[model samples]
Target chain A: MKKTALLIIAVLGILLLRAAEDLPFWGDPQSPASVHLSDYYLEESYEETSVPNIVTSVLADYRGYDTMFETVVIFCAGITVLIVLRRTHRRRAKVISPRPERPGADIILQTAARLLVPMMQLFALYVVAHGHHSPGGGFQGGVILGSSLILLALSYDIQMALHRFKEKLVLLFSAGGVLLYAAIGLACLFLGRNFLAYGAWAALLGISEPEAHSHGMLGVEIGVAITVLCIMFSLYIDLASGGDLDEGL
Target chain B: MEDLLAYIISRYNYWAAIILLLIGLYGMIAKNNLLKKVIGMTIFQAAIILFYVSIGDKRGATIPILAHGHDGAHQAVEAAAYANPLPHVLMLTAIVVGVSTLGVALAILQKIYRVHGTIEEDEILETIDQ
Candidate 1:
């Protein structure tokens, strides 16, 4: 009954938000947002970017400012993960022998890891590259990619996975992604355009505006996806592998 | 009737996405297991991706491939133009944002698990109170 009531409220809330479009209190269709967003982008997008994907053009170029901030937010998250999960040398010394492997852990996980890891990574890369033409993007691709490694850890041993990727390497991968994104922005600044204005650098690269935007967006998205994927695996490692497992064995 | 049904079917993506999102939310808020909560969060985030992807799709539109045509002059007779590729592009960033947030959340959960020796919310709280 409570769940039903909550669902009713949620439905009503959605309806109410939708109804706000019909209200006269809002500005006219000819209002600034409508003029700029719906009309201006509709007409000018093709000319500016030559890309059929208006959302991509807007996100990668027109509103590159917002995307830069989004990248920074992810950078902040990476830092936070390090802060939370970093182990002290002293603590490492104390955690001397590893604990025993949990009963049935080996039998359950070994076969699956041997079979699933490569296939999952392939799917993740596909999602990342085809993002412009399809529904999958850096984030989805990153998670799928990250989860592939996480699955290996879960099915095999957390300690084994940690040794493979290591905390330091994951941290570096996360930092590298943020740096690449910022470096692109700085590159635009050096070219006399605003941050991420790859179109301005077209003269150097000899590419058209649309192609430049596509390349730039791909670069940044790659950075974002890589950072996301590495950080995700790092989190799994932090959660599952901490403390000495062999001591219990 | 057929047209109406077709319209609804085409729009079913949003409904399914919303349902998945709700289920995820329920799992996140109600489940005691930390792993279950993380799984719930993944499902919820996946729903958002589905919603964003569906928004990019237009009825009767083909994939946004640059065909052998210029400004519809030499366009194929059967070509229905292209669906907006922007939403798919935007979703790429959103997917990254979702994973980053999920990573942070999982790290926190891991820390909590470390401190409590158990991942269940009740068990963690009991350990904390003591």
Candidate 2:
């Protein structure tokens, strides 16, 4: 079976190589990808959104519907893990470990994490906030934020992290993140505008139309960061400890 | 052979993606372990992402962040000045989705292990047959 698989792979590789012959050369300026809506996005993003980062403007403003659904997808994934793993009627065994067992074992890692976690969270916030003019956005920033919490779990243990972030609180924050995003949209609608029409806030925020778009993008990015941070940490706690929220590796 | 080499040189990214796809495909087809297959699936997914990103590349272009001058001078914006941002945006979301999927997959695998006591495909099949 392994030999047959090897043969199949070779054949497939050759076939793909032939197909590659048809693709445009790397970095071709006139390639269909760059010729399509990308040029428009590149040209008009700043004028429309007052944000320097074309990618963030496109992701958060132009294609917002896609982002909204993706947020829902992550939320659903977190909830799925909760449903599948959490032991509600566990007459089995609890995986609890209250004491530190040995405080000095991971002294180096603990100290390093203590030093690094704050900086990581700060950088994550920067990435989220400065996404307008840089190569980052809420998704990248949220992952970094989530990793800091995961690092906190790894350095000390799950219980230490859980002390600050209760499951109930995490759930609320996770749900609330999505709610904040929807609320912004609904607010726009209430003001006699379309859902997520951030220009509606131009008058309220006392900013120009383009500036309002920037502010709106910032708001949505914050909402995305909150959801991603909560969901990622919640998912990690569940997956690492099999939903027990106790002693985890 | 020289023509093929030239073509390969010009489109190396696609060729590399194909090689990665092959490696991932082999792992999925030949491996008996479920976890290995999951890793293979990840590799396959990564190859696809690589292809999309490579397709979006533009020679001599800066990052997707538009250049700004604070002096209030209206410089003409050129499309070729920056790399295509669409793929970057799409792939960013894709990466997040990929991570979410991987987490769910690992969680499901844990459940499968707890229930089946093993994570080998043939072993699970045998148990089911018995």
Q: Which structure among the candidates has the greatest lDDT? A: 2
Q: How do the predictions measure up, each by TM-score? A: 0.67, 0.93
Residue-wise C-alpha lDDT for candidate 1, range A51-105, written one tens digit per residue: 4455555665677677767777777776777678667656767434334457766
lDDT tens string, model 2, A3-105? 9999999899888988888889888989988998999998888888888889999999999878988888888898888888777537335433233344544
Q: Candidate 2: which docking quality band?
A: medium
| Segments in model 2 whose C-alpha atoms lie over 4 Å from true places | A1-4, A94-104, B1-6, B71-73
Best by TM-score: 2
Alpha-carbon lDDT, every model: 0.66, 0.87
TM-score of chain B of 2: 0.89
Off by over 4 Å in 1: A1-47, A50-59, A92-166, A206-211, A243-249, B1-22, B28-55, B68-80, B122-130
What lDDT tens digits, residue by residue, belong to model 2 across residues B25-76? 9999999998998899899989999999998899899888888976534465
Error in Å for residue A106 of model 1: 8.4
